[model samples]
Target chain A: MQKSLLIDPGKCTGCLQCELACSYDNEGVFNPAKSRIKVFNFHDQGRFVPYTCTQCDEAWCLHACPVEAITVDRASGAKVVADDICVGCKVCTIACPFGTVNYNQSTGKVMKCDLCGGDPECAKACPTGAITYVDADWTGLERMRTWAAKTDAGQRATA
Target chain B: MKYVIAGAGPAGVIAAETLRKADPEGSVLMIGDEPEPPYARMAIPYLLAGDIGEKGTYLRKSKNHYKDLRIDYLQDRVKKVSAKQREIVLDGGGRRAFDALLIATGATPIKPRVPGLDLPGVHHCWTLADARAIAKRAKKGADVVLMGAGFIGCIILESLLSRGVTLTVVEMAERMVPRMMNDKAAAMLKRWCAAKGVAVKTGTKVTKIEKSGRGLTVHLDRGKPVAASLVVVAAGVKSNVGFLDGSGVKVKQGVVVDDRLQSSAPGIFAAGDVAEGPDFSGGWSVHAIQPTAADHGRIAALNMAGHPARYKGSLAMNVLDTAGLISASFGRWDGVKGGDFAEAADKAAYRYIRLAFDGDRLIGALALGLTDHVGVIRGLIQTGVALGDWKQKLMSDPHRVMDAYLARAYA
Candidate 1:
């Protein structure tokens, strides 16, 4: 079954462990600054939203790459940067609507989350279950069940 | 041919790549002082934001990026250059010869001569080592006092805030980013940051930093002393032009270069922050932005490769995302002498646009919370396109820039 990282921003504690884990897994270093998955803190609102490349089927970064540096991972459905091929032009960083495909100045290549070769370190590192790897088809199963339960209560009250 | 590039910053790296591309048989030696793998200083802010790791800051990712290209990368400081002999002496008593030399030494963060600056808690967020040190002490709920609210300082505020530190920003200027922005635009930015719970002290200076008990105390020019665990000095930067002294390379605020980026010495070129080349406004100024540096690298490499490439003066442009507010400035953002100005501000939407005009040409612009017209503004200014009748319309309604641009260019 295909897997997806389902994120619940409400459950995030802003600890940045997911970022550190993702960076470490991909880069072999404990640097959250280089992490593909980023946690944006809305401090005034007291909200933390961890964002990353959503691995769109028709990725903007893939198409925007002039040298075809960005590619799709067939197995994980992730968009990855072929650093060797990237010319460091930064067109993909502009093409990405979500601002997920960002340019790495050090490497002169654009980078996004590749889901850590399908295991997805961000989901595993989340302490509060804010991020979870689940079956892509059944990601909304819990939400549907909640609405169904609400409908049943409404019908019971009407009866 | 032996090509030596003194400085492995972005421009230097690009120069090496370009040189290698054009002259496949030539030997390229890229030298930098920093011991770490060639990295972008701009990425440090992202590092502070916990966006990527140290490896993410590297200019080339794949193993053997430079090695595969056959470019020699060295991490040795240059003490001086014998420009007359086309030789560079390393600090460790070594000499390297060059047929073509490009100086992309970049800049160094200025450590202001302030009392108690040598203390343990005070740090300059410039290098990888500095980032690690800052990450250690700038813990969640830690009191952090950041000196200087300029472009560099303000850029890192978001990252520091993300790290969950209690931030207090002190700026010597009346407003933030004084070099790039006007009072109104800077004021708007400061208000936006303050509204988001950031403590902004404008036109303020840090008199001294003293150790108070186990923590530290930051004395300000005005108001009460700020208690802090971490004090980040984000004051300013100066060009890396020291190695060229007595080399007859010529120096102003930076190494002086011509339109070809060629210095006084034959076969010597300067690029990036170290080179004070021509500015768009008829004078020489160092545009330290990344895009300009990339252009410099390309042009310098082309010239070195025996291709004639003339650099038409660099333009000053900066786009900043402070907290949630996005702001940008381009060209002579502060209107020139006797230049007409058109401005529009929407306090409710937090949208603003100010257009600078010299005669009929679009000279410069300031924008806040408006990203759609950025490209058009840049294009019109760079081209020096005459607005004609559309100029009057823009003067009345700056939001009609798209329409004016369409009418002028296409219509």
Candidate 2:
């Protein structure tokens, strides 16, 4: 069963716990600038969306890494950046369409979600369950259920 | 059950401690993204002003106190979570299965996408790193340009001014702390800032921030370029919910949770700055203060542990320290439209009080400098005391308001 994150934007209060968890997991500091997962706040719309590297089956960040620093973790299916191998060229950061991968000035290394080997701290720290770890293959199950519930099935004729 | 808490901010650490207290036999694990344990983000301004030292800002429960509680304090962040498998993946390819999970990820400072915002001397005051950066450049005679005159900006200005740093505040709004203070209170604060030699420019926008030699030049909308050795951007913060893209947890402005702080998913919960819970005073409002965040952590942890606790909403009380002056505001100040507006001001004493109302019910108030009757006004607001004959006594002696209310409530 592949594990995947389920995000509910309505539950997100723009808290950076996930970022802090990501940063502390990777950078050893509570620096959001260094976190792989970044929360975007649309103030006018009153929305908080946590965006990160989705670990796409065919990852752009991995292909863009000239040094081959980005690699997929077999066990967790996470695309991770190997800091020692990374050249800090920032080519991959631009290559990614989603802008999930970023360059950290202090470390001069590119950073993105590594999925914490599979047990995501952001999911653990989330008080509202806005972020959840679930079966990766069934990520759309919740949405499917919602739409299924909305399906207008007229009441069956009385038995 | 071994509990793993992520993020060492107030929400994370408080949850860890609460878990220890609730289930003494349960093992606790705290993972901090920052090198330092949770320090008071609220006290950073005092540290910048030299009133408090680096040690004073520490909000930790003593060194290795988690060890005493038999809590495994992991410095690493959890990279992945497998809810079906009941395990968490660590950064270095490690996994830890947990009986329950609590996410207390706090909010991060919003760094706008303005050009040159990432340049040196540009900083935000949400973390120790930001504080240290600003403090390093805030020399004895350095000129500092602060963007955003909200709570953080005003507090940082007060701290910087004490160190003899020339300060200029640039706010896009018409008044300072406009969200928290009404027009009347804002006017009083503006005058106070002016009297203290702080240059406050409201309704002004920062067009560009460019590097000039060792210093930086901040170009304003209708003024000559203001050069500063340092610049602090206290614009505001947004929830740190960016990692939930593929995660099936529902989110809006914040991680939307019901009164129980439970999200759409099972075995997962969010609190602190990340989770938006029910607001009793208003309809489903999210509060981003430290006290409220602490409350969220406690309530969420209990529910996660099967105690079935519901979070009662928190009051949005913003107490500010502007130089030596203290300003505290609570509830809705705008509710008081037009019943009576009364004030007592002394420029020399720096003392001021302005009260507004709608007939009998107390609506809004501003207390500045030093007033002996602040407690009375605060109590009246808290208890929802109708003015009755109290309005007449308030005009002559405001302290009588509290005395009368206390007499009635206790009577």
Candidate 3:
């Protein structure tokens, strides 16, 4: 089974360590502007959502690309863009629903999270354990177990 | 069957690929005048900014991509098309026959009849070769004078700024991107550029170019002469339809194509900037943008391969990033006569949104520094959804386009 990056937005403290780690690991810089993962601040709601490419199954960015610049890494199930092939059309940036894919004006290519080739730097750098890498099949098991633990005789329900 | 495509830009390259997939056994021959591989003209700006190398401009990455598809690529210019003979006459007296033909010769920049245009240190930001020539002189702190404030000119300006050059822009129009943007939006752009230390001279024209000491003196109408080490000419581009003089193909501003992308001549089609196809507004017009070219190319190729596909029409849309400020124009952004409209702007924050309507139908939109609602405007205009109560709601506040779109589209 493939692994998935499970995110708990509630546990996120908005330290932006994931962003710093992501930028340094990939671009060799500490600039959050170049980081693939972004933490959107919702000031009124007092919440921060750590967001990146979901590596969607039927990726619109891959399909909308005039040239097959974006492809899937079967091992990690991460959608990756080939800088050599991208013509910097910026069409993929618009096609991505979550707007995770963005144009790198410096490189003239689109960039997105590639799951760090299965060992995500964001997950390791997350100080609050807000982000974690787990089996893709059971990303909700922890939450389900916690809810079950609160009910009745303390016997957890099999979910 | 042989498929002959002229022009090796985005439309031609894509047409060849689609032809191969549509007809696995069909032989594809694509002709281009450039020595390099098929490349996108849009990437030239990035190339000038040093973001990507020359090879990055290529539409297809692998050199063997066409070879692997069994598509034949040739470097030559089509001098004339003999529709009756179903063949084309090439430069240097070469001839080739085709079962069907596609014209994607794209466009060429209009060279003004001014002296010293052929001088050194003057270039047009169109081809990769031109970008190379520009990179040689557009160094940090180098004084540069750019002509024109049209769409292409603004794009080149952004890239030139990235090179850290001292820049001055001269435009004949009163504002930037006059053809695509409204006066208000254009004013915002002009102010934004000026705030970024760009010397924007709208309503100014370049009268003459003279060689000066160690640089060039660009004479402007009603202004002092501007001195610069480099001059970039982005006046405009004209369709590459001059070769079709006696081809019996109907030509206006470009090679006029029908709904199927077929030219006046049977078995001959035109795509990309060279094609004046159906427009959403009315009659025939050329969008000339990358998205339109890709769409037209695919439709033309599918029809060539015996697939019956109908193209609705090309919509007039332009999205521009002028030195960190994003601006977009959709559909009839200028607004149709007697069309109902709504607009709101915050000049201090540089945020603006104007919506046009033809009886509650979202027909057009213009926006600057207002993202997040771009998709909603596009969806509403493209789908032609009737905005019953939302029309009045939007008129009250155009920024609530997403609210209107979600409420009406989903409900």
Candidate 4:
């Protein structure tokens, strides 16, 4: 089964645990600036939304890469960027519609979510289950079940 | 039934120790997101002031103490928790199934979305990293523009003033600590700030912030741009509840916990800044303080171990030391509309005291400066003692009246 990442904004208190986990795994530092997952806080509305690259199938960054450095990992279905092969050209950062791909000044390379080789750290680190790894095919199953449970089965039975 | 607690903050560490005493056989596995052990949140301002070092803020017993208690401490964050499986997923792709779980994640400072907030020298005072950033940016003679004149901002002012750093306090409210103090008490504090050479711009709003040649320029609503080398935005903090989304836990402002600190989810409890429990003083309010957080940890641990306990609420008390001026307030200061008020002021000494009463019962009291009678007033507010015949004497000489109350309570 293809695993997908699920995010619930309501349970998010903007703790940045996922950010810390992501940065620690990738960069060996607990820096939010370098995290693959970012928690954005809408202060007035009192909401925190953790956003990341959705790992698009028809990736824009893949097509935009002039050096053919971006490749697809079959095992995880993640768009993995080869740092050694790729030149520090920022075209992929601009080409992405969601702007998830970012240029790292320190490494002189572009970085995006690689799903941590199928076991995403952000999903694992999220204490509130704001971020979760579930079956990709059943991403909308939970919401569907909720709406299905609310159906007027009794009324239909009476009719 | 060993327990694993994530986050070695005030709530986490306190629960670990409390649990050790309650259940000797139950070993504790503590994971700290930060490298440092538990430290007092109130002492961070003192550390910034150079009155204390980073070591001075440490609140844990000692390195040997954790070993003695048989706790396996790991300085790492918990990656995930499976409530059904009762297992905690670690960041290193490891899992530890537990009998119970406690999440005392605490809070993080709210960084405003204003432009140039991420620029160099723009800092916050929530964490050790933030404090270090501010300290690194601060110079001996640099001007510091502090946004928000709340409790944290004012405490930072006290810290910065000791270092001889020029300060410009920008507050949106007309008075400082509007929620904590009355108008009269705020006025006294304002005067004290002025006397100490701190430029307080109350009712001032910062609309724009920009980098201006090795410093930041704060453009306010009412005045010209104030240039400063460092900007410490002590706006406030929100509970670190973001990770609990989709976890089947109820969250509102904070993690919705019962009097036992248990969330809607079974076996998962939240405490400290992240958990909002019952506030007994008011109508089901949430108390956010170090003592309350500690209390929540104790109560939660007992219940987590199948030993029932209930949290009896917390006092909303705050003592602030700003540029050597001491201000402490407790309980509700705003009396019912048109309630009787007894006030006395000594402008020369920068001292003022006001007792708001709703007929014989004392509702709130505000005392500023070196008011030696504060101890007595605080006791009256805490114990809910009737003024009785001393009501008339309180209007004339509050010190004598407070003494009588103290004498009565002691008797």
* Best-matching candidate per TM-score: 3
Of the candidates shown, which would achieve the greatest lDDT relative to the real structure?
Answer: 3
Model-by-model DockQ, in order: 0.02, 0.01, 0.07, 0.01
- Residue B108 of model 1: what lDDT? 85
lDDT tens readout by residue for model 1, B272-314 = 9999987876799998877567768877888887877777777
Docking class of 1: incorrect
Interface RMSD list for the candidates: 22.4, 24.9, 15.6, 28.6
lDDT of 3 by residue, B143-261 (tens): 99998889899888888999999999999999899987888989999999999999999999898899988999999987899999999999999999999999999999999998889
lDDT of model 3, residue A137: 79
Order by DockQ, highest first: 3, 1, 2, 4
**TM-score of model number 2:** 0.66
Provide the lowest-lDDT 10-residue window in model 1 chain B: B402-411
Model 1 lDDT, full chain set: 0.78
Error of 2 at A127 (Å): 54
For every model in order, the TM-score on chain A comes to 0.83, 0.84, 0.85, 0.86
TM-score of chain B of 4: 0.92
> In order, what lDDT does every prediction score?
0.78, 0.68, 0.81, 0.71
Give the true-contact fraction for every prediction, in order: 0.00, 0.00, 0.05, 0.00
Please give, for residues B70-109, the per-residue lDDT of candidate 4 as tens digits: 8788877777667778887777677887887888888878
